[model samples]
Target: MIRAVAFDIGETLVCDDRHWSSWADWLGVPRHTLSALVGAMVAQGRDNAEAIRLLRPGIDLAAEYEAREIAGRGERLEESDLYPDVRPALTALHDLGLRVLVAGNQTVRAAQLLRELNLPAEAIATSGEWRTAKPAPAFFARVVELSGVAPHQIVYVGDHPANDIIPAKAAGMHAALIRRGPWGYLWADDPVGAAADWRIDSLAELPALLEQHRGEAG
Candidate 1:
């Protein structure tokens, strides 16, 4: 029985385009330049951080990421930052008596962002807080721990096939791939994504999916 739902924040609940574009503006680069680099890296099945290093050789990636996070904090995320379907889906799940958690490979401020946005989640867990990032099994384990549910009883929904779906399934959680974010539409046909228990175009479909799961579990 699925008793919990854990969502990934970046590109899952919130589109990260604004954050990336803001970083580009702050760094004095054309928005498309940053977009192109990250897109090229994703296309080649490479890490986006590789593009950051390629654009400015010898730049400190961690320090730069942190700097970007700090600058964005001056004007934190708002409800407008979330996907339209996010609150609806999260609310529906909670109303169904399921625990809902929002987890992400993000700075600690991400938790604060969700809190400020009034997202419908029991808890917000960040990679920074856990000190482990996704695509790592331990990260999923921590998600399971925070959810207060066993892996098999949790459903993890996200956009990244490599970072979200694959690892969640490996950790024994059902994976749902939503085809909206950077990797989502591109990876729809990926073997790992296809292997997911559910693949939908939007979180608008999530409530029905949860009902179906509950039906079978019942």
Candidate 2:
């Protein structure tokens, strides 16, 4: 039985339109250009940051991020950025007596913004804070550490199969592939998504699904 549910940030809990748009503006390119490049990279199973590198070769992403922050165009997260189902789903999970955590491949500032939103979660964390990113065993190990539970007692939910579902399962947790974001939709029907123990279209569906799992377990 799953005792906790952990979530990814982008495309799983929040929409990334503002993120990419801000980058496009920073690079002085049309949003569509950067968006297209990102889509192409996703389709080709390449790193999304490769899109930025392709646009301006040898660009130091870390420096650019600091520059953007200095320019007051850094990562921003508002309640409006959250999907409509987020609050209701998280609340429902909490009501079901499950610990809910938000741990994703996001910046430390993004983690701060999420806390400001006052979402119903036990804790919120990011790859930037941990200095570890997903698809890496160390990242999931950190997650297991943060969860304060055995890996098998946790459910990792996200839109990315390679980063979230596949790796989470390999780490001994159940994985839920949520089909909402670009990565989610694109990979939903792919064989790789089959690795997810659960495939859901909305967070609102999670409470019921997990309850069903509980029933089956009992």
Candidate 3:
């Protein structure tokens, strides 16, 4: 049985692409152009705003970026308001007697966002407390230890491949990828290509997906 179901917060349970789009607007660049540039900078381990500040003279772009992110908190509260179906889905999982947890790389700001969005804190398992982030085996290991579940008994779902699915799988957990966002090229948009054990587009689908593995040979 899938004893525990874990999730990633950013872009998986919460939406962040809108924040990026808002940031692009703040930078006064075409959405697609900004998206591409941001992707490149993130790929190169560079700061998108710093890169913009260096090249785009006289633009106190960092403040704009901060404003966009602050707006993301509001948006997460407004838009990511826990999809209409998410509550029922999670309730169903609870009904089935499976433990639910959130395991993700979240900044301190994100914790505030989750609160603003009214995401339940009961099941949350985060890396911020440990100063670690996903794609790091230590993060996944920490999640395992915190949840008190053996790796094979847990099912991890997230929108990022390398950060969530890949490491979870390596840690002996079944992983599912939820495709979201254009930032952090953790996985291609193509869910199948991500090679996750499973994929779903929305959190509403999670209960059924987890049920599928209850009797399967993992």
**Pairs in clash, predicted candidate 2:** none
Question: Rank order by lDDT, top first?
Answer: 2, 1, 3
Per-residue lDDT tens digits for candidate 2, residues 1-218, read 88999999999999999999999999999999999999999999888999999999999999999999998988899999999999999999999999999999999889999999999999999999999999999999999998899999899999999999999999999999999877999998899998899999999999999999988988
Off by over 4 Å in 3: 25-32, 39-85, 183-194
Each prediction's whole-model lDDT (CA): 0.86, 0.94, 0.67
Question: Sort by TM-score, best first: what order?
Answer: 2, 1, 3
lDDT of 3 by residue, 33-115 (tens): 77677667656645455546544667764465466667663333454444455566667777778887776776555565565
Model 3 CA lDDT for position 55: 42
Which stretches of candidate 1 lie above 4 Å from their native place?
65-75
RMSD of 1: 1.7
| Stretch of 10 with least lDDT, candidate 3 | 184-193
Q: After superposition, how far is residue 114 of candidate 3 from its true place, in Å?
A: 1.1
TM-score of 2: 0.98
RMSD of each: 1.7, 0.7, 4.7
Better of 1 and 2 by TM-score: 2
lDDT of 1: 0.86
Instruction: Name the weakest run of 10 consecutive residues (lDDT summed) in model 1.
Output: 67-76
Higher-ranked by lDDT: 2 or 3: 2
Pull out the clashing pairs in model 1. none
